[model samples]
Target: MQQTPSVLTDQLAVEIARLGIVGESSDIGTLHRVTELACQAVPGCAGATSIRWAIPSGDAGERPEPLASAASHPDLAEVADRQLARRRGPVFDVVEHRRAVSSDDILVETRWPEAVNDMLSRGVRCFSTTPHVRAPVLVTLTLYGVGARALARSQHAIASLLVAQGSAAMSNSLQYDSVHRTAVQLQEAVEARAIVDQAKGILMHALGCDADDAFAEMRRISQTRHVKLTALAQRIVGDQGLPEITERPDRTTD
Candidate 1:
């Protein structure tokens, strides 16, 4: 028995949601999977390509930068690249306007003649670009068809649903990356501070001065030698020496 349209859509949604969970680890992986799934799920879709763009904050008018892209076929990838290279075609328009664009017959499409010719040469007769915005990121999913009017409006919901799931997954992945980076930086900072403190203790013992005086002396030496405080501290700890400071100068009151 053939499956009903509702059953097919439900299954597609479930598959896309599963990708969301599995793809949380990688934004690019989500995009690649979405393109592959689009070809399999969307009716009349011969091939698919997706572009992920980073929208700059506080510049609503600024053009978004392309972050990543994936395509199901080489020809489809080439078609999308040519559009980006020329800054024209349905992808560009859809991104700029934040709306969907479609061409039923590229052979006679007037908006982007050159792009149409390129697609025709690559055996793409029709295409649709749909934008999915997920704040700080905008993804455009383009579906390619081999016949005129092959892409029907009836299947647009399926494509949109796929892009939405992909966008959510990408957002979650980016957040995870950012948090991981911040955590690493914080760990490095803590390690650096600990080393610096150890170096100060060594200085206090060698110079017979207080912590503040030792730190001040270390800073002075660091400035004169053009070496980072952390590097100087590490050297002091390793060598167990005065770091070339021969005499213990009078502590200044400040």
Candidate 2:
């Protein structure tokens, strides 16, 4: 079947929007949506799998990990597992080359001997892959088919566009996660500082000492009791009420 580029683009946009909304609730769910979208968007795609490759750090090599996957058939998952074990299949090539790769008949493909043999045994015939490079992590979207000529030959253009849309969604998710983590850390710091300050004020009034002396007393107690200064301060402020002064002949309220 033939579909217009605009139609595919529109579908991609809608799918990305869906993933974005789902990401707000669950990141894993968003990735599952991505694999499902790939199966729907790619022509002749019977199954889909997403592989996440960690960018190599220094001299150590980073291995690719399977993040999420969805298959129209059980055999398709077998194909993915076989390729993963071989680590030299179309998906791996896509990651290495940073482009799309396919085998009309995976059983006859010689590029990946081990993987092809496994695919042949599992009755998997066709494979198509597009890479999404998002720095630090490279995501590979793979499609599988049982027919000899599954995906339309030379359809990398449309596949790339689809991959681009998914990549954008993934990028947005990564940014959102980073911002959320930073906000949590900042909030924790603010709360800790506030509690510490409140405890210091309480200690200063109770001990009739300056801020530095109050802090020192808390620190000593914290060490002696093997508790954090903030925790010790909270206990002191909670257990022993702040000193209240009343005007008297011998002592005036200070």
Candidate 3:
């Protein structure tokens, strides 16, 4: 049972490295995909991946969200998600509590009532979790098998490597997403300003007015037309081309 998955882990790493997430943003969806791969690498995994960080669960806030996962069974996945939301389960808490949780008999682990119940219902017998000590990063590596005692020592090592790479991938993805969003916003603003200026040019020529007067006129048209000044300017530059000052509408709603 364990022999095949250990080999698969090395093969999986080669495949995962080709994913090209280094020094880049890893989207939530990509993280989910990698987690699914981890589940697949292990023979007995029931196809579930959990990636969560330990946030300060205080007297006043809900726990963290399930950052990403791709589970084979939807119901079991929901149960795992809820456990994360509550901040009271083995996967996240083991890391939070700074302890290793290993159980051959999940039925007797009173500390994890909901997780144990969920595992039993899902036919998952042996569950083990190790705390990942990447500070301020609440990452835990989990390994479990259906109707079994514990993962082979080799399997545990394999799971650790998978989780480590997954963590790095997720971190890079977030950074890239932030940068991309900022760049898009900047581009949009620059484009909007360019349209406004072109509209201003058209107004100045058509109305035979100063730059300030042309802008005020554009704003007036925008308000009157119930459209953005940028849009009005774009229309002046693009479609109907800048219209006559006489084309400016009244700004009164009544």
Report every candidate's CA lDDT. Answer: 0.83, 0.64, 0.63
lDDT ranking, best first: 1, 2, 3
Q: Report model 1's TM-score to 2 decimal places.
A: 0.82
Candidate 2 residue spans exceeding 4 A from truth = 1-13, 20-28, 240-254
Please, what are the lDDT tens digits per residue for candidate 3 over residues 146-184?
A: 656646555666566666666666655555668899999
On TM-score, the leading prediction is 1
lDDT tens digits by residue: candidate 1, 166-252 = 887877777777889999999999988999999989878877888988888889889989999989988898885656677564675
- Evaluated at residue 176, the lDDT of candidate 2 is 77
Report the C-alpha lDDT of model 2 over 70-138, residue by residue, as the tens digit.
444466667777777766677777776787788898666778887777667766688778887766556
Query: What TM-score against the true fold does each predicted structure earn?
Result: 0.82, 0.77, 0.68
Q: Name the better of 1 and 3 by lDDT.
A: 1
Better of 1 and 2 by lDDT: 1
Model 1 pairs in collision: none
